[model samples]
Target: MSISTATVKERSLLGLKELSRDEIASILDRAAHWDRQQEKMSPILNKHFVANMFFENSTRTRFSFEMAEKRLGAQVLNFAAAASSVEKGESIYDTVRTLESMGIDAGVIRLKPIGLLAELAKKVSVPLINAGDGNNEHPTQALLDLYTMKQHFGELKGLRVSIIGDILHSRVARSNLWALQKFGVDVKFCAPANMQAPELAKYAPYVSMEEALQADVVMMLRVQLERHGEGVLKSADTYRVQYGLTEERAAKLNAGTIIMHPAPINRNVEIDDAIVESPQSKIFTQMQNGVPIRMAVIERAMK
Candidate 1:
């Protein structure tokens, strides 16, 4: 299960917490390059075979990676846990090893287990990319978010960003906190007491929702309603009044400030339905930006 340090470092996209600023910048720059391409398809990865393995359910992340891989001309294999042998109790490692034995050039994996991706990277010879791993980090999501911000603002330094809602279970927030700090961006969090991630307080301040809306970016996280039992959230209406980006609150934002949400949005829970597509909102832009950013990431792994 042991691997060389060079192998692990060179191939895996485990998380952004360990990546240096320059390393992150390079990925963004590469993503920008990919974004500029007018051609719909490139054969850079022509002969390479890559696998998209997901042990957890996903919609955007799964399809985004698939689109990126195909756009680069890499042969692709898709695996879903619900439809696979995993239902019969096959271990993740055994499944990955089975794929490795089939000659996949690289693997894109999403599993629910925290910290297992790092451990899996060490044991697997082929490079592994983290799709979204159990609230630990969603590096590609952060990468695209960084790319989108850089595209609009021209620089990340000194930019103010407040990530509001569901911080406790958001891998997006964790990944963005680590990556944005590398560029000297001021990142803050805003959430209800029960929804906060206290461990991250040392890294970023938890601000009042009123104060959070004053920032350069108001990034709303999806309210994880499934995690909150009946008593946990009195009702969606209660959460909206206290923390959701209602139209009144959105109207109060500075004209220059932008709105954001990593989607599967709750429509009226975390943000108003009317604001989801407003001029200031980058909700769809984030999804579009994901493809090129992911292209940059998959290219890095395959090449």
Candidate 2:
């Protein structure tokens, strides 16, 4: 599809890579509208049916998507992979098609495998919101992260954001890099050699934690212990000492720097428990913004 066509109608938010700058701006604008409670009283999505099909366990993303759909006055069908026929050798394509067959307006999915979502995208005509897909991208998470930043700083251009943690498995990091780059937000990744994503070199060369602490925004990624390659974790204590955001390190940051993490935090693993509650931390606010940002996405997508 042409850029113009994409701008008006995005079928599935598979990844931020497919979104143009104008499209990103439009989504953020709509998100702000929801954030400020400026939405119409009449439900924009009345009678629409949406499904949240999560193959992986989640506390935030799955529930937030359900909340977003309901707030828009859409009926929700929640599907858990553990209890579903997915365990019975059913394919992702067949499952999504089954939902579409039931007249579901859209589907939100979080799958463990990387490319299954793209395959489902090809087979289904209804819109799909990627909740999280392996190490690929989490487009809505990036949208809410950007929305949170805008609420605090009012703009993105020229602002520096330092992302720290398990970059290779972080869909959050990849999606944010795409949006940040479009908005002219300078980005740097800080991670141990074992955790850094090499493809992110174009954003900014990987920097030490000490070096990245100087940025306007300090974003921490959850260390994906579940997906770390074999032998990459020699010692958790060693990682914390070198890269984790301990209280001592948090105290050293610029007073004006915004601390963020796309949470389900690993406590003292990615960031210290004390720092997670610090005045500078926007982790909770990021979670709060998820609903509105997701509401905006569902509203725009089903239109």
Candidate 3:
């Protein structure tokens, strides 16, 4: 698609890579405001329409955004590619343009194409919120993560965060890296050699699992076995022995340190099932936090 030189009028939340510290802080603060409200539904966005155009499958993100939009009283339209014209070979651009032409105020889109969201943003006049764009970024996930950490630790500056697992294929990892670095957090990555993103080496060091476990936050990435080439790693059992947050490894964490994961967890693969909801784990809290953070994002996009 050809890029447009015309000015884009809408305020979109595409990613955190270009967001300044103040801008991110503003979003988090607004999320906190929404979270503290007494009423369940606020009609701040009444009469506005928001369409969730998911070219990829999701449960948590799609539901979370829908919940947020509804809470603020916006009408929503959910689009699933598998059941739509997309399955018949209609292009993604056409699908979004069709919605835009129908007068949707903004779009929440998720897709596997890495740079397609950016290209679509140029072509579409309505605001676009990226649900996830390949492995490039998942901004709201990272924002909720920051909110979860901040709620626990009080301040984020000088915190040490180690993100471990499939670094090469995790949009969560990339989003967290960019957002955390803005807050002066020391971020580290721990993954198998083949799973490392070499381009990010200058931004953060690739550390050993033992070293990663020592941080203030030990965040595990989902082991995307499907994204890996066949035989790239031995097996899930072998991966657990080496990199998974087994019960033994969890015992070694500092009493003050917290464990986290972006879920649809692989049970015993990336992390032991016993440790997922333990006192030290904030895995589920991350999901709960997503609603408000996304509410803040949608409010920003529409208002």
Query: How good is model 1 by TM-score?
Result: 0.97
TM-score of 3: 0.97
Task: Kindly report which residue stretches of model 1 are placed more than 4 angstroms away from their true locations once superposed.
Answer: 1-5
Please, what are the lDDT tens digits per residue for candidate 2 over residues 83-179? 9999999977788889989988788999989888887776677778899998899999999999999889999998999999888778899999998
Clashes of 1: 0
Worst 10 residues of 2 by lDDT: 1-10
Whole-model lDDT per candidate: 0.93, 0.86, 0.93
Ranking of models by lDDT: 1, 3, 2
**What is the per-residue lDDT of model 3 for residues 112-181, given as tens digits with 9 covering 90 to 100?**
9999999999888888998999999999999999999999999999999999999998999999999999
User: Could you tell me how far off, in angstroms, the CA of residue 60 lies in candidate 2 after the best superposition?
Assistant: 1.1
Candidate 2 TM-score to native: 0.94
Q: TM-scores for all candidates?
A: 0.97, 0.94, 0.97
lDDT (tens digit, per residue) of candidate 1 on 164-248: 9989999999999999999999999999998899999999999999999999999999987888986778889999999999999
Most accurate candidate by TM-score: 1
Sorted by TM-score (best first), the order is 1, 3, 2
lDDT of 1: 0.93
